[model samples]
Target: MLLTPFARVIPLPETIMRCRYSVVAACLIASFAATAEQESIERLEVQGDFRRLSVQTIAGSIAVVSEQDMQRSSAQHLDDVLSQLANINFAAGASRGRFVQVRGIGERSEFIDVINPSVGVLIDGIDYSGLGISSIAHAEQLEVFRGPEATRFGTNAMAGMLNLSSKQPDFRRDGAFSATVANYNSWQLSGMLSDAISDQVAFSLTADKQVSDGFIENTYLHRKDTNDIDELTIRGRLLYRHSDQLQWQLIAHAIEQNNGYDAFSLDRNRTTLSDEPGKDKLSSQALALRSDYHGIVGADLMWQLSWLSADSDYRFDEDWAFVGIRPGWEYSAFDRYQRSREQWTLDYRLVSDDQGRIADNTDWVLGFYVSGRELDLQRTRRSGTRLRAFDNNLQRDNAAVYGETSTALSEQTTLVIGGRLERYKDDYRDNGNLTIQQRHSMWGGKLSLNFQASEQAMIYTLLSRGYKVGGVNGEALSRAGDDGLEALLQQATFEPETLVNAEFGVKGAAIDGSLVTRVAVFHMWRDDMQVKGWLNPELGPEFAGFIDNAGRGRNYGIEMENRLVLHPSFTLHVSAGLLKSKLGPYVTQAGLDMTGRDQAHAPRFTYQLAGDWFLSEQLTLQASVQGKSGFYYSDGHNARSASSELVNLRLNYQLEQWQFAFWSRNALNQDRGVRGFYFGNDPRDEYAPHTYEQWGEPRRFGVTASYQF
Candidate 1:
């Protein structure tokens, strides 16, 4: 795949055919109304649930973004594309955002713990949930599977899963080169080449490097790069086929990021006053190999092996101020944390052959999965003339056995059932006299019924269950000086949480494929719901954070995605999410009653309306308007971010195989917040509490040029 700033006219893969039927479908209007065109919307194949199926056959809420959809705009990272989707958002406190929230449930940050992500992230068949990905270099597709997926993935996918795939080697040689220059002293260069090395072998390689001065200005240091963005991603892949019954795939990727993190401002804007700005640095390498063979009687076998090694150093100013700001009374300090992590995974599966059904008309699959992780964490702090160090070692192991079966009850209906039994264990030890071990055995499953109403419409209902692993807080508890706070020690350990979800969805198209749409409504109940709780920040690092179970929780939402091919030259796309999330009877240690209140980071509504205008064979214009309602920033406080809307525009021109693009994101230049806090950092008012927000990107325009060969 090449990073061209234009979409290619490609054929749909595994799409539902046109059907002269009607279903009660409601679509949100994005722009002007249009007339039907002769062109049809493109369809995508989904690689979830251990099967390659179309959207109509998948029994859940799913969103797919292609290389063309991503490269058409100023979308460099996952966060840039999340807002265009429904009911998805991320928390940003690093070079790239770390926490990915689905339906208002997920971790907001990871400071003192090796937290288990509720939403799992897979990049090129390897798990990268421990760290955030900075770029999507030469990615072919991005798929977001919403709701519970415990039957397929164990604890890592309690909320959902995100799969990012890079382009594989093509049969024929193809490659591209791309470059871009934008505001804030930002520039990027990328190149890719792929070809067949032999009749049965093919290879692909891509490299991307992007650097920026960022969007922050430090007044004290007289520098504008206190918050910067610098990243490089290199990807390589190989595919080998011996015959129709066997194949092999190998993938490797490496990423390096050296970015600044002085984003907090005493003025609460894009300007800062930190004398010693912090840094965010990361280096990661990963490899994965997979093979499939059909030698077993009536069954096929598949296996995969993957490993990842990463090193990260995240540091930030503790005071958010300069030394002279408060003279001798200022709190001047730096907090830095470093981690080295290694992870490996192995998966094996057996599936019934295409012609081999277990029963009358049932297809079955069985799988076994196992993974292990080792992490070393180090924290160094400097306060004036004092320096303190802390070190910890963490280990985690997991194993699971899963199986699924699908049976055709009738020509128009099918029933699917799946289940998984998993075991998780965690061990932690630190130099500060804290040793903890925890283990859990859990199970999850799903039952789904599919009705193929027509060639272009499918209706399904699903009931699924998911679970999340539980672990102790090593950083905070390590500081627990054996003071009689045995009660706090008892709270240090929490239990695993589970989610049961029910969903009903319909996928269909009408008017000769001019109107393609999908709507899904889901409701989920959380039992022993896990939530991040704090003892007291003022009590030092010892009582900083812990995990607790809220007796109960509820999240329900409706998501819809629609494409209207009003005319051959113009198309309109709209995606929206309406959500209602509530925490059970739970009160914070600070006596903040949050029962019945909306969950943090859970917006009531999110929407995007976009349109494409093809003026000529060589020119195209795209525009979009995205908006989100305000929501609580944290559970400890009532501070919230304001509702905001953004407008984006892009114009592309194509000449043969060369392309040019003019793009601007947030063209309206709204001062929106990506993250916020309610804690006090002001010394002038004796550390009074106030809301501080990390403002989003400002208006910026850029030009991109690419050559495809």
Candidate 2:
């Protein structure tokens, strides 16, 4: 396979090149003058490598992004970091980067009903699955497993898994603080400190706060902060080494967000007419304990226990504007939703030690997982002075046992197999005072063969199966009319969805580690695919949405990633993904045929190119170009977003113990849409349908200063 040429290229300033050469020449002379300190400097280089480049491959397709990479990109959110990866997309809703879609699978909304997300997310081993607001200010590493991780993560990982590891306390005393000021009246303050409390104990703490006057402007209210943001995050960790072979860590973290959510407008621009813009708020906390023991005979044992609690409020102006915009329309409303969730999880695992002969030839692991979750939801709608409300409660319990083993059959060949058996149950109750219960048992697994073609390359193939549990539509049933309440209850229940996927890929490091590349091709078949649909409520004019088992679907894609170290001071990175999707012949309950249509949010192509140049020991420059081909927004509607391209840049300077950086996002100021919908939101049009879009961020630049001690 050959590399594809970049879509566009812009030339750099000649003056910038001259400045770089001058700095490089001065640095070379300083290097020659410090020959006696070469060994000490080399030691420092190796220590930095341990901190920034240490990586472990979990599965064939898993990718790990280091902390240094995150800092280099100046990523304030997960989407900022993942936007540069291959085969990844995000569905931005009323808030920021909420739902993530990977390899053309995942959901876009969870407004009216509870959903089982295809992608799983974990922060320090505590599940934050569908929530996307956790701060990454002190994260050490991010691992993305880009396949069905059923054997390890169970149902929630039917598509993939995202794991975030926070920085840990070490036997070194260090601290750092940073402040950033950017456009749109945005500023951030963050700091972290770590110290060794004793010979066997260490402690670390991190805190950060971010504030921004958002992009959108409310024309009616003459306000620019209607969609603003304010967020805070804090975390603490304690590590204890009980003995040479045993260690344990305790972690606690909290996050608070108060953000406005006025994203839509009738004109599809960055200005809105809403007079009563709503707010999005969240308060979340988590605690976790992990222990590792290496003293077991020929095996290592690990245990983890975690608890998470979250409270969220999401509201919006039901009407884009107050009445009087149209002659005959005089209607206004407000909608508010409050939700709280609590979850507890426990996991235990054992793996063979690699020191023994059997372990050297074979790798094996076994694990058990158990979790329980509870959720309470309340919704209120107001029209004039009239108000209507609904409340619901949901509970879920899950347990699974899984195992995997790989053995070397020959010098160049290896075979791997893994499987998981899971049991899940759900209970729900709504304002109608009726209770619904459901239970499911599922099996998922994977099989693969890996071949080491040469010292510098390897090729592999895999087949995997995964499933998503089903649930009853309690809220929809509660709103059912009296004529067929029984029949509607039965019709509202949905079955589980299953997927079978096959993939082939090759990865290699060439030119003595100066260049690295990975490519993968995959095909997936879905059975009884779960889909969301909107319809008229049985008893009201308000529309309602629910999950259903649509017919089958198929998806296929190719992804490629490459990194080239052209010189000691220059590096380049490229990634590209191509996808195709189709739905089998199926008719929705609303009498619409979605056959032959692409899956929602599944873009046909996504690509990114990035370059980094180090002018001298104190100066660095980075630039990136990212683009995505557009796709449909829903199965029931024909609305589509246009393809978009964006450019970003960052420059950094270091002097002794202090660093200064300047960064710009969306430097091109492209007008792109991250989300879209085709529906009637205004009553003045007599419910006539039209397209609306939520625009992406505009061009913004910022400066940062940091100090280390």
Candidate 3:
């Protein structure tokens, strides 16, 4: 069968129709306040699980997709699905997908939080931290929490946090697997098995392999490098129910991936690097232990300890002539990074099982946390006789003590408050072989009031402070003749970045359980911002910039998330955001005015709309459309990249013991551009195009099958 260009595009007629209906429905409800039935139905919320509900309450600016949603959605990667959420964007240079940015904050060739991510990520309760934005395989759910949620998840949660949980054994001793072949010579095979090893223990294993012919072209080069990706993962868990009073669990996970970096195409909107591709590899191991005990006094105690180690190797030689061969310079870089991070937490809480007043009418929790990390970042670059080596070794020791208490002001109101005192110490070593020590301490607190407005509605207001520690740099050093050791000690000093956030929110369920809505307004202030910049020749081309206490930023925004259960067979989910980020006065190498510029990658407005329809008990269809307003790509702030939108669709069939589905992504094939700098004889003309590969998956059609026993 011959296929037309449009054959690859997913149909969005239903998506448009549903959007129109949503607008109409919202307007009708606003105009007919007297319709009590309409009002009740308009307040229905879509979250259906208790554990998920807990996550939502504290992980503000969060979005959750259930396992069922993953199965019904046609997405090749988690980021492909996440791009539909608000304020999230992906930048693929040439042919490689390298970084994930949330609220305009994260970017680094290596994963050490050099830019201090405003976003954080957790997979299966383990902090899946890294510099390059990679994808996860066989995930059960992806929980995204936007904004600085340091109080709960800690520092890196500055921009936001993503938590991924794999599916656990269901104790049914069931397993299934499937394979598929699609366009671009893409092939994938995946399967999993679960069974009880003993009366009190169970084990499960899942694995998959995938390969794809990348999309892009490099006229000067015969072979393209960025289009290949490979991954392997294994997870094991054991549960021991010692008794009603004591229970414990241990989990282990390991993963390895060899991913190509197409990053960008020779032409805009293309990523198929006809020449050589960049190489990126990531390997990680993690172990976690969790224990819980119920005391005689009705108190619950929980302890958790986790250890993780990850190593990443990246090699890129994008130049046709190793160096100085063409009108433009050839560039190549290699980086190796190793991170070992450990965390220990203890929590003890006293509670009254019955709602009737406790002996003290109070509930409390005591907690202590400690985390230590070792990071080694090293990179080597060679361009036309210029061989430069850079390395930074950073060690961090962190500890904190926290306490929270809650009291019922009345049957309809509750007040909660908590505080954490944290200390951070760092040891740094640079390429010149110089060493320096840095230390910092601070406190964060949260206060909130929750009011039950009625049986179906509630309102809450919260205020909190967040902090991120800073580190030293390797580029600044006065070299001694031999050993490349430093002659003078110019201590690299960076201060901590801090923010105070205040928010007010209202949540309600109405419209006969057909609709759910939540609205929140927030304001935040950040100080001592350590903005990032590129290297310039006049500044030596090797010198990185660090602006100390370079003014501040003010962020104010509104968020709305709603799910409309219009009918048992048809459901609609809609979310919208309006955000404003303003940078304060800061100095650049050229003394450029960096004030009032949108924080590097921060976007102003974002939204997502989706619908699910059951054509029959055996067949279902789903569609989603999402977009971001637009954002700046560079620190000097030269250009404003345009915003893009994506549309996706999926169809599924259910049978007694098997399931099958097909889906398409990036149906419109939109072009995404990034901001970069070109260093040459003319410094003023330094600005050049660093166009990114269009995120469009071209057009993909595949069938997936799974079974349960």
Model 3 earns a TM-score of 0.83
* Candidate 3 per-residue C-alpha lDDT over 133-153 given as tens digits, one digit per residue, 9 for 90 to 100: 244445566766656655555
**Residue 649 in model 3: shift from native, Å?**
1.2
Q: Distance (Å) between predicted and true CA of 308, model 2? A: 0.5
TM-score of each: 0.93, 0.89, 0.83
TM-score of 2: 0.89
- Ten residues in a row with the worst lDDT in model 2? 41-50
How many clashes show up per model?
A: 0, 0, 47
Return the candidate ranking by TM-score, descending: 1, 2, 3
Write candidate 2's Cα lDDT for 581-613 as tens digits. 877676655567888788888888999899999
Candidate 2 backbone collisions, by pair: none
- In candidate 1, what are the lDDT values of residues 1-709, reduced to their tens digit? 2101101222211111011011133322111112334345456888655878877568899899887777655787787788888898778877677688898888888886778888988887789895866677577788988998888878888989888888778879989999999999999998889999999999889899999999999988999998998999998899998898898999998989999999888789999999889999999999999998987777899888999999999999977898878765567788899999999999899988776786669999999999999999899988788887889898999999999999999997999999999998888888877788888899999998887776566777788999998877664465455443334555666778899887767777662567778887777888888777766544332235567777788888778898887898998999988888889988876567888888888898999999999999999999998889998887766889999898889999999999999999889999777888777677776666678888878887899999999
The parts of candidate 2 lying over 4 Å away from their true place are: 1-58, 355-360, 481-491, 536-541, 683-686
TM-score-wise, the better of 2 and 3 is 2
1 versus 3: better lDDT goes to: 1
